[model samples]
Target: MTTTVRIATPDEVPILNAIRTSVRENHMTLEQMADYGITPEVIANLLRTTGRAFIANVDGVDAGISIADSAEGNIFAMFVLPDYEGLGLGRLLLAHAEAFLHATGVASAWLEAGAGPGIRAHGFYAHLGWQSDGLMPDGQLRFVKSRAALTQIVAGG
Candidate 1:
């Protein structure tokens, strides 16, 4: 199967949200996700504004998504369909988001990982060399990565 990652358009917000909702490990139901501000309208606005969203398609099917808020030096979101996991799509999307943030002159990027059985992101971020920076105001664990460190990691030393 072939995979392609590309900038996501505003029109793809629904697909992005769908992928996010399908992740049982997120520990959030559709209603809860909306309460947490994961609505399509919010995502669409992000796509239209300072955020950069990328979609990963496998065999021409929407499979994953990654989003970054360059202005805030934060990874706003990243999700892959359960069926598409273990295919390196998440890593690819993350790399693209980090590159985009670095290109925007961001020195560091951060993201909040929820605490629960449904939250499987901490290990993934940790595997990519991100460090935990304590809890965010919202109580989620904050993960951070620096551009310089990422550069060194990519350079293999």
Candidate 2:
């Protein structure tokens, strides 16, 4: 499935919001998302400010999305549609985000994932060699990865 990852424009905020809202696992309702500051307006502002939002298209369809905060070295968000899961789109999006961070002179990156039921991101991050740094104040699991390590992994060490 020819997957392409590209930086997103402000106009694609709605599409990015749709991909984020469509997550079946670690699901968050619109109200819950708003509580966590995940509204479309917030996302649009993020895209405008950082220009780090990326969309992954599979066979000409939006399959996943990722957003990185280069200044903070944070993988702020990443989500893949349920139907697109297990096809490696999520990993692809993550790599794209990490690469962006690296290019921006970030040596390390971190992200928070849900710790509640139906959350499977811990395993995914671990499998990708991210180090666990325990839970955040918000009760989300924190994972960190170094750009040098990722480069080694990608180059087959």
Candidate 3:
């Protein structure tokens, strides 16, 4: 499927929130995700943030979402829909975030993935050559990749 990435507008908050809920539910314990805690307030806050949000569409249908907060030149919150998994859409979203971060003068990007069930997410990152620096607060694993490094990986791929 052809993929397109673009900056998400405020009107796309609901779609983005739905994508976030879907991704969070996939990684959260069933008991915790039972209620599906996404709210418009959360979406509003995210839209108002300093960071950027990206939406990915496959064949013109919304397929994924990614957000990156600029912190010490480190990008964050790279996520994709489960249905879109294994199709390299995650890598596309991540590359978009990295380019955005790098354009904003970030030399590196960092992401956190669940250590247990979320371990699958690590494979996606590692496959792209991101280096794992191990655990972080909340027991998630941390991955660090330089913008130049990711550029090479994506280019080579």
Candidate 4:
């Protein structure tokens, strides 16, 4: 399927929220996502401040969404619909996020993925060549990749 990715606008909160809900329910454990947050207000605020949100449409349908925060070049949120997994969409969105970070003049990107997701995200990061330093206070594995590496990845594609 042909997938199109674009920057998100404020009006896209509901869709973004829905995407967050999907991840929270299917991928993130309640303990990992934390019930205290994930509210509409919180998600909205994140989309507004941290950085940019990008939505991916596969064959004209919303398939996944990701948020890249300029602060520390974090991959704040990344979720793909269950059906859309393994279609290379996740990698596409990640590359988009990395490129966005690189454009912002960051030398590297960092991300934390909770262990409860059942997706072995730490391994996923490793597959992408992201170096894992250790776990965070939230019990999430931390991964970092240099901007040069990500740029070469983006250019190679």
Candidate of highest TM-score: 2
Which of candidates 2 and 3 reaches a greater lDDT? 2
Clashing pairs in 3: none
lDDT of 4 by residue, 1-157 (tens): 6878888877787776666667632465434445746555665676678677788889988888877887758888788887787787778888888887887778788987765546456667789888988878867778888888774334221
Greater lDDT among 3 and 4 belongs to 4
In candidate 2, the residue pairs with backbone N, CA or C atoms under 3 Å apart (3 or more residues apart, or in different chains) clash, namely: none
TM-score of each: 0.87, 0.88, 0.76, 0.81
Report the Cα lDDT for residue 26, model 2: 72
Model 2 RMSD in Å is 3.5
Tens digit of lDDT per residue, candidate 3, span 37-152?
53556545655775677888898788887777665455445567778877777877887777766666667778877767646778877887789988987687888987777543
Q: Give the alpha-carbon lDDT of every model.
A: 0.81, 0.81, 0.69, 0.74
- Number of backbone collisions per candidate: 1, 0, 0, 0
Mind giving the per-residue lDDT tens digits that candidate 1 earns over 49-86?
87888889999899998898978899888888888999
Q: Model 4, stretches more than 4 Å misplaced? A: 24-38, 116-118, 152-157
Candidate 3: stretches off by over 4 Å: 24-46, 152-157
Candidate 4, run of 10 with poorest lDDT: 24-33
Model 3 residue 33 CA deviation (Å) reads: 9.3
Task: For model 3, give the RMSD to the true fold.
Answer: 4.7
